[model samples]
Target: MIVISDLRIAILGLGYVGLPLGLALSRHFRVFGYDSNPIRLRELRQNVDSTSETSSYTLEHSKITFLEDIKDAQDCNVFIVTVPTPIDSNNIPDLSALCAACRDIGSVLSSGDIVVFESTVYPGVTENICGPELESSSGLQCGSGFFLGYSPERINPGDRSHTVETVCKVVAGQTKGVTELLERIYGTALSAGVHVAPNIRTAEAAKVIENAQRDVNIAFINEVAMIFKNMDIDTGDVLAAARTKWNFLDFEPGLVGGHCIGVDPYYLAFGAQQAGHEPDVILAGRRINDAVASFVVDQIANMLRPSSRILVLGLTFKENVSDLRNSKVAELVTLLTQKGFQVSIHDPRAARLQAKAFYGIDLAEDLDESYSFDAVIGAVGHKEYRALDSSKLLRMVKNDGVIADLKGIWRAYDFPPPIRYWRL
Candidate 1:
């Protein structure tokens, strides 16, 4: 029996999803953020987040304690897991990080404590996989001695409008009483209120499908882009014309690569496959998205001759964030290099050292240097890249240079008359 007033919240895995939630929860409850990475803990204490999702001011002002050891989180009654649920080499759901977080929480878990999982996973992950781990490790009976809950995180890395507090939250628990307790806890921070799900599996299914839906939508647009390329029609222009229809979904075509959209579908698909149902649309979407890197490479190669100098606009998975996990830009760079093109990657927010360590590619921070290229590939629609003048960017290329706009960031009418442009 725990009182709401005495709730001490511990958030595990303080990355993009956990950091913001920890900051928000710390305002009302005694919050402790735990991560296995000591470097991350040190960086957070100094008000520096490599992810760039949260500002230094917010981290500095938030009354939250940081811990690198699992033992430090023992006193917390409400544990929230927000670790990354990434995919393996074969595009399978690799639950190693999530399982490690659960195992750590289980070791320190006490009776009457409530564990809430915010990591995006397939249905039955929290109750079926994590709950048993907790019970086995802590020697406690679930629902009787300890309780479990699932509240899928809706944290978009670059999104400003739909933040942690503003977005509607879905919460579920082992039992009805546990559900009410989670609702009260989350309702304190979420201004958009909370939706109490029937069960933990339903909550997990809802979150996984959210990203899967986005993946399918983007895959549809990417396929359209490929079709438009064959027809010599601008995909963006067609989308603009189609937008006049009231019921049309305005989904743009681009490389779908990130921690969530690219990976979450696998988690759902894996579970679906285990249940003996082959997911056609979901697997098809994943296949289309996976092949987009090579498709982009082919389009770029066709636009330029061999041994041409190409500049890749951004390297991070998305714009304005430093997260490069499972980025598709690397594949584009590799394919372009293999085709005898000299590629130079530049991103304002991405960490140069991390990029070099992870991808073996050095990132150039300054684009002001006088270096002209045969083409400028707008791979990512970062705000910094979008704000640049078309004329200035055109000057970086030769008279007959090509501009490959993957995200359609530049207007076709705005490009110089002599320059050739290709957009998806």
Candidate 2:
């Protein structure tokens, strides 16, 4: 067994999850942070965290050595994989990034090394899929020549409270010894302690369902929002009235985007179908949530004139974060564009180049109140947009134009007679 003092930790895929975890672990162990993106490596070297999860001050003072090439981490005994587990166009769980990380780590894998995966995936992927890939590449037998562990990542981008050190970590291993090692590793990093699952697959299942449950809850609220829209009743008002009860679950209605909630349910759904369960409620929730962008666009389009010039505030999936992965705002913009609305997007947090490259939509350089649009849509609830005074918001919209609030961030502000306020 490797002691905490002797552990040489290598964190693969230093994005939102791996970077902060690496910084925390570096306090106890000699850490090597490896990422595939050269640009990311350069940015981190200069103490720039594009994800906004880590501060430049923390990055500059961290002891972990950021590496562009995997070979630099050859000496590490504990390799933690935190790569993305995205879905295909068909919504199938795509493990290409996870498998590639395995192969990369396998190339330099040594006897008695432990590879722990933090990427969210369905059950059996660690033992069935990733383990074999490591063995085929390194010619090492699982549980003997090397070991595997699971510690699902809980990093929430743009969230300041629940962090890597604050959240309770869940860990499992192929063997009791490996599990104990993970306990010591993560336990030292997280002040909130850890929950040791019985096995690796159990840990995997626990992680996948975390996001799936949130997806379903939000889907229900989104459906209710649509239902209330027909009756001309505000969903916010209904929620406020329902909250007087003790047991009301408070999930808001909005576009479910990001790498987690929008994507993880499909992994669970895929696993259920493979086990012969239809997963009716799960798939139905997905369908309702996935169609929310179109629903929002339809409502906004009906209120606007054909070929009306529109300005959309915020393009990232959620507010106050630069991460645009699987953002539904792009879908909203595309839908509006298809309906003959001339739309321009403005998100101070999102990367302009990435937005253009990913969606072919050019983000406005700056918010110019001097050039108002026929309508202004609040698609995301960024703090910057939320802090905008009513006068500034009114200035963004032309006379008799609409103020479409998708997330209800500006539901209280009553516009003048010529201008109208609309919300989902």
Candidate 3:
């Protein structure tokens, strides 16, 4: 019997999700945090988290041992895999990282050990795909020799309110004993408590739908935003009036891109197709959300000259963070460039190297007061962009330039007669 007292945890992938989780769990168990990137390990050792999810003070005070080599965590019996499960170029579920983590854990998996997955995936991935992979690499029976568990992670990057310790956790296991074990382990660490799922597949389904539902809701708002644009109405004003209803879901429209909401719906759609069902609504939502960048490009292009010199603000996936995975701003920039506009991008929050590496976007070092553009586009609503008042905006744009606020950040600002303002 694997007792709660004997739990030695190994956390794989120390990025956004794993870093915070490893720090929280280290308080309750002996945690060995491992990431494939040696540079990430070195940064963490010096109390630096590039993801900005965890602070330097927290890293310096944590007792968890960080490791670059997965082999160093061989003694850990409880392995929690928090690696990313992103979609490939074809929008198919890429289980490369998940499978590789399973193989790594299997090499060190001992009898009666438990392997829990916190990465978002389709319903059958934990049992149908990962189980066989673990069995093949470990040479052990899944249920009897080693156990499998699923607990979907709910960490929201750049959101400090809902964290691993504060949010309710959903967990499941292959057997009743294993389920109870996970409940005890997670229950002790999280003050928000745990919801024990009937089975592993049920837990997986719950996680995927959480983000898929958001995708559909945002798609509805995005479609509405475009319709309002054609009608010469402001989407922000319409939403402001509609929000008087107490139960109205306040979902703003913008480009949907990130690790979860932008990617998880594809996993659900793929699983539905594999089970002989066509997910029409789910797919329609994805298509609508994907086309938002193009719609934005077309709207802005119509207002400016063909040879207009434009400036784009912010490049990260969302406001106030350094995470650039699956960012829709890159697509928007590409479309603007394809339209023959001379575009220069500036993001105060995004790393210069990552901006260039991920999207071939060379971020401008600084927004010089003297240099002006024919048009200024507010793509991402970072705090720095939000603080740009009317005077600062006037200094950046030419006399007859356009200010396209895609995120409604400057909707209330009153620009001069010469500066034309547009938003969706």
| Candidate 1 global TM-score | 0.97
For each candidate, the alpha-carbon lDDT, in order, equals 0.89, 0.92, 0.92
Greater-lDDT candidate between 1 and 2: 2
| CA displacement after TM-score superposition, residue 79 of candidate 3 (Å) | 0.6
List, residue by residue over 4-123, the lDDT tens digit for candidate 3. Answer: 888899999998889998999999889999998889999999999999888899999999999778788888888999998999999999999999999999998889889999999999
Write candidate 1's Cα lDDT for 229-313 as tens digits: 8999988879999999999998998888888999999999999998899999999999999999999898779888889999999
lDDT of 2 by residue, 188-298 (tens): 878999999999999999999999999999999999999999999989999999988999999999999998999999999999998888998889999999999999888
TM-score of each: 0.97, 0.98, 0.98
TM-score for predicted model 3 compared with the true structure: 0.98
> Where does candidate 1 stray beyond 4 Å?
none
